[model samples]
Target: MITEFQLLDAPAVPTVVVKRAEVAATHLPELFDATFARFHAAIAEGVVAPSGPPFGLYLRMEDTLDIEIGFPGVLQSPDENLVASELPAGRIASAQYWGSFDGLPLAWAEFVSHVAGQGLSVAGPCWESYVTMPEPNMDPTTIRTDLFCAVS
Candidate 1:
């Protein structure tokens, strides 16, 4: 299947994140599901609390990976416990994946190839935005993800 994604510039915003390491593609669905579920629950229960227009979710990776669910606007640093950082403004190459998370790595590979083919270098870490709400009865096959790579 051909994955299609659009590139755009996204501004920095406040986010809440959880760190994990050596994650496999097979288990990513559950990881994403559980991580976002907790983030969503926090929003619903007024735990983390939402501050602005909820649009993008970012994943920052090095040796380990950190998944950050970004809320729109600048969120307050409650008890000064949040790990919020301002991501510098830059160009990004993005694509939309409308399927199970199993195919996400491949989709991201395509994005990387596309960026390279354009003679562009990656500027920052990559992340996937969960643009749609996950339903209990919904098939993972029908889930949607927006993969993004920061570029210069």
Candidate 2:
């Protein structure tokens, strides 16, 4: 199911991220799997956490190492390596979707439709936050994800 689009002033939160020059669509699954693993491992071991799945995660792009990804309170800025912030604040246009990441295009279409309907435009690249582990054996109909577009 698709969710109503909402423009929210999202609070910053701690995050763990990996940088890539270009993430081709063909590699999304592997990228997501590895990233999700890092996030999950952090939470499970108390290195960084919400005690469970995150409400969402942010993906920011940069031509240089000048990037930041973060969660609430804690922020990290890496130099010359595509900085990953743990806390950064901004406006977010978000939507929630259930089922596997394979259906992400549908959700993106929905999100795009919602953004247009609201007369707002997406400001940056999209981010997909896992609400459940990415297990190949899991039912595709049961996975949940929160998709977000940064708002300028």
Which candidate ranks first by TM-score, i.e. highest?
1
Residue 135 in model 2: lDDT: 70
Candidate 1 yields a Cα-based lDDT of 0.61
User: lDDT: which candidate is best?
Assistant: 1
Off by over 4 Å in 2: 38-88, 134-137
Q: Please provide, for model 2 over 1-117, each residue's C-alpha lDDT reduced to its tens digit, 9 standing for 90 to 100.
A: 667557888776555444554455566557555655665555455555342344324344333222222223221333232233453358888887887777877887888788878
TM-scores for all candidates: the values are 0.69, 0.67
For model 1, residues 24-118, the per-residue Cα lDDT tens digits are 53565676567666667666656565554333344555454454545543443343333454444578787777876567668777778888888
Give candidate 1 regions above 4 Å deviation. 1-4, 19-34, 51-82, 86-88, 137-141
Question: Candidate 2 lDDT (Cα, whole model)?
Answer: 0.58
Steric clash pairs (candidate 1): 5-95, 52-72
